[model samples]
Target chain A: MSLAAFLTPESHSTCRPVGASVLGQRLESPADIADITRRVWQDSMNVLQAPHIYSGVEMALWDLLGKRYEEPVYRLLGYDKAFAKQPYVVVPFAAVPEQTFERMRHIRQAGYRAVKTGWSGFGHGNIASDLSQLAAAREGLGADARLFIDAARIWGCDVVAAKRYCPLFDQFSIEWVEEPFDPTALNAYADFAAHHGRMRLAAGENIHSIQQAQQLLNIAGIGVIQIDCGRVGGIGAAKEIAQYADLRCARYINHTYTSHLALSASLQAYAGLERQDLCEYPMDPTSLSWSICREHLLVGGDGEVTIPNAPGLGITISLDDLQRYVVDLEIRIGRTTLYRTPSIR
Target chain B: MSLAAFLTPESHSTCRPVGASVLGQRLESPADIADITRRVWQDSMNVLQAPHIYSGVEMALWDLLGKRYEEPVYRLLGYDKAFAKQPYVVVPFAAVPEQTFERMRHIRQAGYRAVKTGWSGFGHGNIASDLSQLAAAREGLGADARLFIDAARIWGCDVVAAKRYCPLFDQFSIEWVEEPFDPTALNAYADFAAHHGRMRLAAGENIHSIQQAQQLLNIAGIGVIQIDCGRVGGIGAAKEIAQYADLRCARYINHTYTSHLALSASLQAYAGLERQDLCEYPMDPTSLSWSICREHLLVGGDGEVTIPNAPGLGITISLDDLQRYVVDLEIRIGRTTLYRTPSIR
Candidate 1:
């Protein structure tokens, strides 16, 4: 796993943006094979087919792979040698395990260092009925809160007993156990990511492409490369699948689902492949957290998320902020829109 | 294409929840998979990585193959011999090509039929790059406005004259020319769908599965098959992908984008395959045409739509009729239902 050459001469550099994924929006847009087969068979016979989701052509191929790589999509894929900033948790199940462990001890004592667990109705049965509601909210939040578990597996249930419920995900300290199955169960979570590589497992965000993340990292391979960085094609296509999943030694995370201009464009695709991993913060205030980023979501007060040192994910748009969410998402105002298409002529 | 007879009728009958996509709130029904993966990663990651877009997980596998074949998802598949009724075209695009061709020649002189056109942009490019605005809206709408040209694609531009711009889509007679391009140019539209399959040469609605309709029916292969029927997972997953694209012969259309309860769940999955096809009807009023159901999309006076015999997309929701678009998305709702480390049985 080596390839990090250097020694160049700089001019006016800095290129970050391909943060959306699942095959870079059918590869930077090329329709008209008779109008993309008449809107792909009129949306396969009339709308309602978002099975897994993420669209704007993987956010314009993660803004054309962060302006074709000058670097930032998680340090061109190394998750920044692991740890620049990653801490999430907003489980919200309409309350009750002592109010979800006092909102995970006030989002980890207001630093939101990390959190997630809210699958209600996958309830009434196993994970010991969601381990007695997080063991009665960890006996009512005694120490700090840092946990994770996401069973959604495309809304279908009975997660094949997530490995005899791995001692109930090692008694709720579950830092991994996501997507309980779907995306072809990646060889049954690669035999549950080789018997819990120290409890880390996590799944790919409903994988869209990079050959379905090289077929779920050649089945059952993920010690923690959750990636999503905005559904796989936006911090320049998650810095080309976090630089080809940082040549396999795996470990990256960015799945923050939109606003904070997609969380500083997924902290600039994990500010170069992961600083510490964890960015799923919706801070739960609703109309779907205010129709998600209808204003480009930006929370602070040291719960973290500084990163936005500028260039792209410092996000700058004011066509009345694109006419307040989808006024037909148009842009073209000025700044001589540099290079044009046909794969950069 | 003859794998029918397989009933094995025993005893299976418990299908209720008539209509629901819900998520309106209580912390947005507990942030359903992070608010449906952040309100569908911008058009679900460009309609699931385009290869002429066919993400058909069998339209939710035919809502589970017409509730395991009680039959309705296009009569379980065979699309009920392709057309008893599915004509839709509601594209007003923000109107004005002489009031959108006099409302598409008054919905084809009020019999209420097939129609789709209304994508302009003008200011700099597209109305199919202006041949005097597609010959003054085809000499001010006479041809029953069967137009269908809309230009919702241009991926910012530099499209190196996509097939020398097909003489203004052959002067707006255009019965098909929807997204124009963006799911990574499926081999430059399979070389323009093998240089135009007899002109009407259509497309799917930015497809999302069935291996992207079997790789655009094994390259440039399309006559028409458009499927979407609710994010490819609802009307039992587009009738298990129109029975696996009817052994690659291909045919289906439904992508009209929501509420006629998802076009009456795409007319019971095209009433079991092929209804000749045209079910889109989106004409516009708003809020999915006035708060989702009771009725507003309107096209009657005989213009088509009939379909609602009542059962699955036949509609029935009442939490006091969705308690005025519900709410509780949570700015704060903690009593800490914490499930800290445990040993439940």
Candidate 2:
């Protein structure tokens, strides 16, 4: 279980953040570098021993290891390169209608089989208007593509949101509706599930810990349990919960914690995991989506990513890349000027 | 229910994060930030209907407000600050033997009623030496003063840990031993707890979500339940579990996510709570232990902090103070050179 053996044989390499010119520190030891990643992951947001608490690092270290490992991240996670395509989503929150459609078209062309969209707000003025948008969005996705509408629990259109949403779920043939109304709304969601049990609900990554996962599972028995590994702190706990999901007949989906390494580690946790569907490959357009980790995650022609073949994680760090773009870690901007401290050392 | 009315008419300073510092953009309505806070608090975390995922930020805001409001956060739920003095422990870690004792004397000088120490390792040359250290540390603490000892539960010390550590607890007048092992080792911790129930069994904040809390509560009630507001993702969920503890006749303590504002907020919640003892206040020297919401949490002369008396937590964020320290929201620190990103603009 020690990632040591797998990590032992790697030449050090540097990590470059996307759009940045300078190199980050070149990692010397994969295991030691991995420890740094783990600590950072633990310190942010979620601080509980909840369902899971995971830590990961190695943008600089992972890069060196990737080259030494001679394979990508997916292959390391036990994913076969043949099925190297990844399941993904397109968040159309701030996009115009045409832009969203265009984005979806590009994603489709780029080999993604499914796309999720329409999450900013349900601004239909009424439930009917919201429903119409869903109908149209589904039509745009067409029969060949899978479409997910992220309403973010805007199901408060009174009777429409509560009673009518599920039927609409069936109408649009939605893959699964997420956080239709937050955790408290589980009973309402359950009510929907009880009646149109076929309308499949997807949620849980928003949950910060395992105990919450257990409560959510007990309360709703969700169709697709989307687990956010980072929010819980790390991959180990997610592994346990994913196993529980497999045993319980519910599908587990990796909840995104905003980085490819976080996403990749979760993909590994899902290895041999039953009832698991997709590990959200957050391919946002921001340089952030590209530079946040040590390596750029890719999907193969088969619509899945081959898990990293190297030990620990076959992450490739590019210090030069990250330094090229980063000016500070904690930045503050006022209307007149931005206050930033460069890494003087 | 709202916090605005509690503030003096002249109180209107707002602390804006430098990156988003256009002050008036949010002050459109009559000074009613608490109105929004209340709504977000109510709708998102608190009263979030069961089976919902709780986020920590929402609760932290509430905790911050409670301090600002000069009222026990729990007082909002209609409970009073029950204790006359806020009894808490200063964590002692990362210190050599002599230095740790020297620091303990200073903690005593600061008027703290109790102190807790972290675990180093347990065994020596493998086993015997480590246990000897534990005994020496316990003896040292007792030699200087009567205080509580928190076993750092570094794991793998067999039943000897249980037997040796269990009796040492009584030798030091240690009220309750913390985690001491993995979460699943409920039996092991319980075994130790059973060995000393009259002293009061303490645990939780590590137990994520309500489901795990339920498991802990079921495994024979511990005297004190420490819940971490950050880990649980907000005050609403923390309260739900705290209230559940009230229902079950167990005491609850806040797990430390100790920002000055958060501490005040916890005091407020404790005011509203029925069953709960002191919060795990981190006395270690970190900026986090003091202030973060652009406010200072002043402890009352009585030792117990008087919960905020103003609307929300009565915290007035100082934009100037925030600007002084925050460089970037996220920085990538590698083993060698840490990257600095430009200030958020």
Q: Model 2, range A199-289, lDDT digits (tens) per residue?
A: 3666675565454565466555567777766554345556567777777787777876366766666676675553355657777647564
* Reference-based lDDT, residue B264, model 1: 61
Question: Which candidate number has the best lDDT?
Answer: 2
Q: Which 10 successive residues of model 1 chain A have the least lDDT summed?
A: A1-10
Model 1, DockQ value? 0.01
Segments of candidate 1 deviating more than 4 angstroms: A1-83, A86-124, A127-129, A132-142, A153-227, A237-345, B1-83, B86-133, B140-144, B154-204, B207-345
Q: Find the 10 residues in a row with the least total lDDT in model 2 chain A.
A: A1-10
CA lDDT scores, all candidates in order: 0.46, 0.51
| Tens-digit lDDT track of model 1 for A1-345 | 000001011111111111111212243222211232233222321221121122333343344444555443333334443243545755644345667667666665666556667566443345555676777655444445566777655322234455666676677676676766554445566666777762376667756444456546554576665656544434444555655666675655666644456666655654654434456665554434234444443446654555654333435444443434431111111333221221211
Residues B175-242, model 1: lDDT tens digits: 66654544424444556656655235455565554455544555445556567655444444455566
DockQ of each: 0.01, 0.16
User: Docking category for candidate 1?
Assistant: incorrect
The weakest ten consecutive residues by lDDT in model 1 chain B span B1-10
